[model samples]
Target: MKKAAMTIALLIAVVATAGIVTGGFSYDPAAAQAAARIKVYSAEMRNYFMSDEIVKSKEEWRKILTQEQYHVLREKGTERAFTGKYATTHDHGIYRCAGCGLDLFRSEDKFESGTGWPSFTQPIAKENVKTEVDRSFFST
Candidate 1:
């Protein structure tokens, strides 16, 4: 992560330097051509991922969700016990991912586990759920 940040900073610095090409490096037409080729490649990559079930950049997600929503969905966060609006909610609709709006648990499957957070018997479908190792400290 640190390396990625550093690389981004370096690229920014290079771009700033490019504005004053005579300062150190000479302007090269080949570099511009190479950049155009990269743009084409990026367009192709975007087209490939366009059909994904959920495809959005981190910034795009942040724009889609409010700060609190992003923290829970993108950051794999858990709401405080007895604090979530849905914790005590009893609606007749399906529970969906706040991030991508994917149908997760149906209202009929909801049950009270006395665990504060909403609990469901099983996902609406196996493909809609992913059970990763919850590395949060709360996952004792």
Candidate 2:
């Protein structure tokens, strides 16, 4: 478990640096109050997962999530562009994971990427998210 956590932490750090490029947009790190918000959300996110890690069976997830969510999250399916609820939202708040309710990104980190999906500059904290290399369709 420790090793896994360390590996995830390292991956998260790498993802943080890659966040802007991955989304094809950038946010101003010098934006007013950005640092304070980051600190607040980072603590909130850390506290959120202070308890046991979440582990749910597919059957359980199906019961908890909508069919669409199950398709996108569990089956690794994609939603049609611009169809997500937060895709065009301009509200200010932290964005939580649909599957586990983990606080993942802040509204401040989000930018207008025109990709029809909500794009964030970074997670609230590197530790709050996980990353993996996608080696699909002849790309890494």
Candidate 3:
């Protein structure tokens, strides 16, 4: 009985160590492929942003953009639902961050979803905007 218990404990330790070394569990090739695509897309988008010619300081931004825009773009505030001019505009220009002027969504991607906020099927690039998990019930 003592030997059996020792053997079981040793096997458990071995299995746990193997799991840590081999990345916890079975691998999914599809997940790996998706992750790779996301990585490439992210890199490309970042490069695109870095290549753009616009440059401005925080002070310059305050002068150029409205208070709300400044708060949304610079301070990461979410614009109030149904309040952005771009939510209704159908112009052919790129939607930029009004505060930093960083090109965000393309005009072509904008669609009227009637959700009281501007909606887009996709952003121009992943690097153009930053997203965080909004846990506040009112945020969504």
Q: Candidate 3, which ten residues in sequence have the lowest lDDT sum?
A: 36-45
Backbone clash total for model 1 is 0
- Choose the strongest candidate by lDDT: 2
Error of 1 at 102 (Å): 1.1
TM-score versus the correct structure, for each prediction: 0.59, 0.61, 0.51
Q: Which pairs of residues collide in model 2?
A: none
TM-score of 3: 0.51
| 96: Cα error in model 1, Å | 1.2
**What's model 2's TM-score?**
0.61
For model 3, what is the alpha-carbon lDDT of residue 51?
35
Tens-place lDDT per residue, model 2, 1-140, is 99999999999888887875676356666653443342223445345333335668989999999999999878877688999888889998888878877678889999989999989999887766777766675775
**Candidate 3 on 4-67: residue-level lDDT in tens?**
9999999999999999998889998987765543221232254541233345789988898888
lDDT value, residue 72 of candidate 2: 81
